[model samples]
Target: MSCGYLLQMDERPTLDDIRRAPKVLLHDHLDGGLRPATIVDLARENGYEGLPTTDPDSLGAWFAEMSNSGSLERYLETFSHTVGVMQTTEALTRVAYECAEDLAKDGVVYAEVRYAPELHTAEGLSLDQVVEAVLEGFAQGGRDFGIRVGALVTAMRHQARSMEIAELAVRYRDAGVVGFDIAGAEAGYPPTRHLDAFEYLQRENAHFTIHAGEGFGLPSIWQAIQWCGADRLGHGVRIIDDIEAGDPPVLGRLAAYVRDKRIPLEMCPTSNIQTGAAKSIAEHPIGLLRDLGFRVTVNTDNRLMSGTSLSEEFAKLVEAFGYGWDELQWFTVNAMKSAFVSFPERLELINGVIKPGFAQLKWRGARPVA
Candidate 1:
């Protein structure tokens, strides 16, 4: 008996379909996704004249171009401007608010947007104040736009404030903060350096993800999971290095452990390409990871830097792999399941929003293929 699944899977999803499909984002950076116009306005208001261009279009292009340098340091340098203008309370709130609104418009039903609070304290705002401002903005934006935005309080790995940030994250757990993370250059500044923070979160039963396996290699991934006990791996594209493609792909000890443990990998395809983690979207390790039944989730590491959204990421995947609604739904569900939100809330979204959203699109373009 024909199951009819192949018929619906025959046609590729269009951009519209991709946009309307309910999406979940796990690794987006708040400082990395500001509106170019907002950056310009904030820069001028703050009397900061460091922007490469005052023109919004040109500034946006410049951010993308600078990020495409294939050097993690250069890609990170783009944040100096975004973080520069976000020191004040008003600026932080506005940026947070708009981040939620933009994600809602792109059909991201749930997102755990992260930012390093330490980076926003240049103008004397305390870490607590910065967290409160961003939380307020996320609350307002969520109420207005009908999307759930959970803030991940991040500590720069190179800095000495991971424990402080982890405490801040726990303090705001009930308010809006969902988890904790350490983000920045992964090479010299390993996750082990922030061992105190990870240990604290673990003791407090708070969830956290470590930025690993992007700029670095398996050692980074291994330490994040084994030593630090990250709940998820941010930009874990380098985990691909351990898997040797064969008739039946052979997984090294680390790879095998990751798959066996069902550790969630937040794979950001375009951002990986931009940072030299992957050659291109078509050759991204996400494809192989998904095929191997690893718990993989799609993400926009930085929408502004990669010039991408959750919908755009899914659209690119479809274009590269010819995925249909079912595949998209699978990825969405995987993200929803891996989210730091409470189990009941995750179930609510999976059943209430995501499943129904994709079901409507599943048969829209299906036709019999000879």
Candidate 2:
């Protein structure tokens, strides 16, 4: 059944209902989603002594607080500890496995988790070793958790290893790696700086998404899409700057192009707020972009940092924008469509998993509570 636009008066997805529906995640970070207790355990096991707090509760709160400092640069610094402990093969595999388990528990049927290999090579392991350990963990996690998790080998935009990482991503494409990405501070480290990696992926028919228009502005986005030819825009919230609000809300040339081509905007509401990308969940560009028919999909950029899951993200939107089952389902379908997977696989998940799951929720919602 196709997704309906109508919102039944009593049909908005509660936090409980949202948790039961199938979902797809296109933008998420591996290091950014570790369980706080796991971090403490890894630090102890690895003999790495850099955690701000040994207590798991304080460490979890520390991540959320540090990430909420309202500066993207400072927010990114929180990764040092996570990346520090993740240097060992065992540490990397455990984190990846638990990531799959956690997402499955939250009802995420599919997710593409991206991580930088160079970040995990601090301990003398090769980049291939890092990727292999992560892939193995996710493979085991998927079997145990009944969820599908794909890896997107990421290259840090601030660093110079993008070409090598792009090659690595292609090498492991068939072995659970789905795509490539450039993630980091989007300001000084423009996507154009790594044009070689993006061009190389393009020439080889590989897929990639660029971190653009998040910490920077339109020039970053233009460079990613027009120059490097990114397949999707990671946190393209700044595209809202190009539109003039009015009766029809006139879109500028760049905005028009993005909308016309259906470029997927991987908007992470809580993370955006934490990074000062938006003021709050209620005033996020996602609401405007969704209303304007842009292909906007919701995501939990960093589950631990944001102290949220996919269900919480959707629930926040429901409280902020009064979203119902139809809106939630539309976002799920949009994410499945924007996924780096093959068309047939995306279609199967949309039809066989997402739609049926939401249909059941809506049917139950339209009836009185038992």
Candidate 3:
């Protein structure tokens, strides 16, 4: 487990060092992380020839470029191709399998990959079938690749099927679905619109995260926590808007409440930049949030779209904020602690896997001072 090269004197950890470090991902879109080649093959098999490019490399570049348009709507439009080829059960299983494999290769020890099951019913697959296929793929991937994968069944915020999706999530809670979520543009369709689904999840003692404070501002975050009772805030980058980074750094009521409650903020740095939530990684609120003791967890919102992996995200933070092994370990532990999995399982992974993994890396040498 020890990467000796990372122990070199006077050296900041390299990308390879970050790759070798264990990671925990709490927020990633299933449809948004498909391999470009998989998309091409699935499209060919399904005879859906609407792809911008037949070549996988070009297709991958196209997705990155489209998602970098600085408009959340334009970024989301890139999903049409991914979702188009993911309608069939085989395709769903394959995509889910590859997602786990890719994350494992990048050193993600644990991940909760989420997708809106309603988006894949075009081929007549039931919501339950969609969940089952994805679960089967994750189970297979875990057996093959030594990584634990959990499914988060998401409902689109702009749609009216939140209650049904919530029901689907509760129904499959013991069958591999770890939690429920709502994703989409956060402006016009607030998390409050799905209050019934949130309330239902609360009643069932289920866990759920809300897509808030990304494309919108403080009001969106306030409503997600105050109104809907979100367990975590998805891309809660907008909380930065309420913080005054002056002498002693004053936090607004909403930001203070989020911090006081220790609600995890699933911050996706690259995706936030792509959506214009943060001007740059150097300017990201995650640095301040971490400094201020907020429960912050780093994530990859969409690997394919952002052209990033969990390792790459960690590397970016290292470069931007001069973070080192200790900072990296802090983020990883935060994510593992915030996972929706059972407390005993979470503790086992933290003690047996994540802690040991970081200890090996730290044993390599002293981390550079942050």
Off by over 4 Å in 1: 1-9, 367-370
Worst 10 residues of 1 by lDDT: 1-10
Residue lDDT tens for model 1, 1-370: 4445335544688888788888899999999999999999999999988789999999999999999999888899998899999999999999999999999999899999999999988889999999999999999999999999999999999889999999999999999999999998988988999898899999999999999999999999999999999999998898889999898999999999999998999999999999999999899999999999999999999999999998989999999988878788998899999999999999999999999888777766666444
Candidate 3 lDDT for residue 60: 97
Summarize candidate 2's per-residue lDDT along 1-370 as a digit string, tens digits. Answer: 4443433595577898899999999889999999999999999998989789999999999999899988889989999999989999999999999999999999999999999998988889999999999999999999999999999999998899999999999999999999999999887788888988888999999999988899999999999999999889999999999999999899999999999999999999999999999999999999999999999999999998999999999999999999988899999999999999899999999999999999988887663332
lDDT of 1 at 183: 90
TM-score of 1: 0.97
Query: For all candidates, what are the clash counts?
Result: 0, 0, 0
For candidate 2, what's the RMSD? 3.0
Which residue pairs in candidate 1 collide?
none
Off by over 4 Å in 3: 1-9, 366-370
lDDT of 3 by residue, 16-92 (tens): 98888889999999999999999999999999879999999999999999999888989999999999999888999
Deviation of model 2 at 84, angstroms: 0.8
